[model samples]
Target: MESAPAQPGTAEWYLAEASKLRLTPLDDKDADPTQDPKFQERQRKIVDLATKSVALTHKNPEKKQQFEVSARYLLDARLQLAMTGDDEQVELLYENARAFVKRDPASHAAAHGAHTLVNLAYHNATQEKAPDKAATWRSEFAQLANHYLQTFPREEPRSVPLAYTAGRLCEQHGQIDDARACYTQIVQFTPDSLHGSEAERILRRLDLVGNPPPISGPTLEGET
Candidate 1:
């Protein structure tokens, strides 16, 4: 016999409902779908379902997988809403990420949440015109990067890219000390890798007042 469907209030039901509401193709590629009533309505439903699923699985240890899945969906839905230029959703995304990381610091979803924050920081810095907001995002990015580094070991694959991004952003914003700290971590952890080599070059450049000399090596004939 076939099994019955998940009950309406259960986590599985919410996830199923959310999965059913896929975005359809738009007639105009350049048109902003977020402005369409149908699109907005669908997004709202998705956000609602994802939020409910997270709540349902919050304290259920046996439902840890479901919780992570719900958190991912929640963040994704919030990100979509935030892309509509909704400040509320953007703030909620930050809150959601923080909460998720706090609840499951070592989970893949937590890492993704941190990465999402980094993306938001980049968007605010490059795309938005508000300086104060951009600064706030940068600060948050630095904080998240530090937190990730502290939480995950250097051997973790995600660590290197996060360190690189954090270092570059810090250097760009004149946080030389913070940048050096990040780059130093990369160099110490993986000195032979591409990121480590690049980090070493950056550290060398930072040590000088002006641009450092070009990197040269001996050719086959031993010519400099």
Candidate 2:
């Protein structure tokens, strides 16, 4: 028999009972109704339970409850690591991310798990200023990027970051027009996101070097 829905708090017992649910339709209104995109609830529970088990400190979770949420998948965790100047932690974050990808090899949800892998593994080749350590993991990074490109969603209520990442990869490949489409999508989809400044830089870098063309979308409130 299926179990009852877990309450928000004190559901650690329930959350710990992990099960693999892959190939699930993202559009189904009933799809993983309990799944939070950022896994905040399980994370909160894990932090709360940290004192109880020496192994559940974000990296390790008891088998029954696999909070196995990679730091990359948890924006808050990544931000904390950045604040603490923990590059090693960031690397561990990628390792955890890879594990999530492995856990559900056929999952579309596993797509973003590849995000950190690309961001860290190929930040240089794809980003504007290539880094010094270009040789660290080029082949593996390229393979991951290709895999992401193959599975990327075309339409989304929030695809700015997705488009931006695609543009970066195009920039590396010298596909100026392909990159332009991706950046244009970024400006079109989520102009107000944290990527605004970076997106603007990219638009100009792609040769839209003058004043930005007037954007036509639902204007933000208070903007005449």
Top-scoring candidate (TM-score): 1
Residue-level error in angstroms, candidate 1, position 173? 6.2
Q: Which runs in model 1 stand beyond 4 Å of their true positions?
A: 23-40, 153-159, 169-178, 210-224
The 10 consecutive residues of candidate 2 with the worst lDDT sum are: 16-25
* lDDT tens digits, residue span 1-224, model 1: 99899998999999888887754554566767667666767778888998999998988999988888888777777777776678898899889888887887777677777767666665565555677766666666666665565566632477678778878987897878778888887888778989989999999989884666777999889998
RMSD of each: 6.0, 15.5
Count of clashing residue pairs in every prediction = 0, 2
Give TM-scores for every candidate, taking all chains together and pairing residue i with residue i: 0.74, 0.36
Give me the overall lDDT of model 2: 0.47
lDDT (C-alpha) at residue 160 in model 1: 78
lDDT of 2 at 126: 39
Alpha-carbon runs more than 4 Å astray in model 2:
1-76, 82-85, 107-109, 116-146, 152-224
Q: Which candidate is the best by lDDT?
A: 1
